[model samples]
Target: MASLFQRRRNKATQVERVRERRHEGFLRYAGFRWAKISASLCLLVIVSYALVDVTPRHNGGSWYGYTLGTIGAGLILWLTALGYRKRKMTSDHWSLKAWTSAHVYLGLSLIVIGTWHTGFQLGWNVHTLAWALMMLVILSGLYGVVVYATLPAALSNNRDEMTQMQMLEAIRAFDRQLHTAAQPLTPEDTAPVLAALDEDPFAGGIGARLSGRYPDCATAAAHRALSASRSSDAEAREKVVGLLSQKQAALGRLRQHLRIRALLEIWLYVHVPLTFALIAALSAHIVSVFFYW
Candidate 1:
């Protein structure tokens, strides 16, 4: 009886393992198919552009520009459809890794098609504005790509699966430990510890955060003060200094975490506004082209 039960349990586990494998295979196939279809369509548009001759129209317009723009717009529409389809399908289909790969490669292709559509012309008009906005969107997207590709790995290695708040909490715990360790020090030696605790962590403005030059970082100031303080017991003073060094190290880690987060967020500011502007400019450009012709 015991042997029969064990065999049944193993069989059930094997079935579950097979199911999981099948699910993963399905996901891989879906992702590959999506990428393949989008890529093939893009290639087809490129080939059509090459085969179909578009002569330049007079009066500040060209058949080439209109043709390229129409094809580019179609690709953009298809890409947008894929995004919507992925969202509707399931979360796994829109994984960050897959979305990022699509975003970067497809976005680069947009730059090529959009520039060609402009025919390298720039002026004080809606067309120029549309072109500029598209460039800004592409540049901001590139920034996001770089940050996502590099910083997430760095953040993972630095944090080891811990959340940002958890990392900050750990740093604070270390600070508390240091505070306890410094408890035995004399008043003269304890001044820096007090100063560090009193310091404002969020006093810097946006510029200071971006530039990484905190003018009012009390931790550094306290360390300097501690180093210069004349103490009667050299041994105790050295111990306090050691604790201050550890505090500085902890503070540095906290600042690094903040910097990485800031880098991740900064590009969105450029991207979102440029996207809105692109929409408005594109609308005007389209209307002008059709209405005037």
Candidate 2:
């Protein structure tokens, strides 16, 4: 019995390792388990919407509409809970990964549930506002998903195993070399080298960071100015120019890193605020339905 138990435990451990390797992404979680469930749900809603007949045709005022509305509202509330779920870390049946998978797939099903609840009757009202907000939230979420899936690898590759501080250090080292190399040059040539040394790597604002374009880069300007020197101290000018070129290359890599990071995070600025607006609009919609309508 002891030997049998040991064998079973070893087999369980091997199986678990395989499972860990296979279940790497939330999109493919449980063999797309949530996706299959969500698809079935959408199909059911679509089929029921077509088959079930209501007096004066289906509309938000009908019993069927109210039922669909309740389901949709419930789903919205649950999906919103995902923000809270992220606060706690767990690896159980309802793990964060599992919750996120469900959030994405089930949240997508709202398009069917919400539209069917309206019975295709849309207008200029809080109901329509709520629907629009939900769609915006979903679209923003899709954008976040796409960036998260694709940009992380690019970010890692661009980093080249160096931390941000290390990149800055490299530029600083080039500046030190430029300072020493400029000592023998004339004042006119040294002025540009000094400007490059004093230039801030992070001088540009958010616009420049996101775009990765530094039109006013002092390093580049200095390199250009020094490169064109026809002065007597040709060797000293060349050394300064070379250091400036290396500094510019370092700055480019750093800016590229900033741009990728900005792309990854900017979506949250749109997504989180819209989620709050959606909840507010959704609340007003529910209250109006029960009390006023």
- The best candidate in terms of lDDT: 2
Q: Write the per-residue lDDT of candidate 2 for residues 1-293, one digit (tens) a residue.
A: 99999999999999998888555788878888999999999999999989998999999889999999999999999998988999999988799999999999998999999999999999999999999999999999999889988999999999999899999999989988988888998888888788888898888999998889999888898888888887738777777878888888999998899899999999999999999999999999999988977
The parts of candidate 1 lying over 4 Å away from their true place are 1-60, 76-100, 160-162, 174-192
The lDDT values for all models are 0.68, 0.90
Task: Give the root-mean-square deviation of each candidate in angstroms.
Answer: 5.9, 3.2
The lowest-lDDT stretch of 10 consecutive residues in candidate 1 is 21-30
**What local lDDT does model 2 show for residue 49?**
88
lDDT over C-alpha atoms for residue 68 of model 1: 72
The backbone clash count of each candidate, in order, is 0, 0
Q: How close is candidate 2 to the true structure, as a TM-score?
A: 0.90
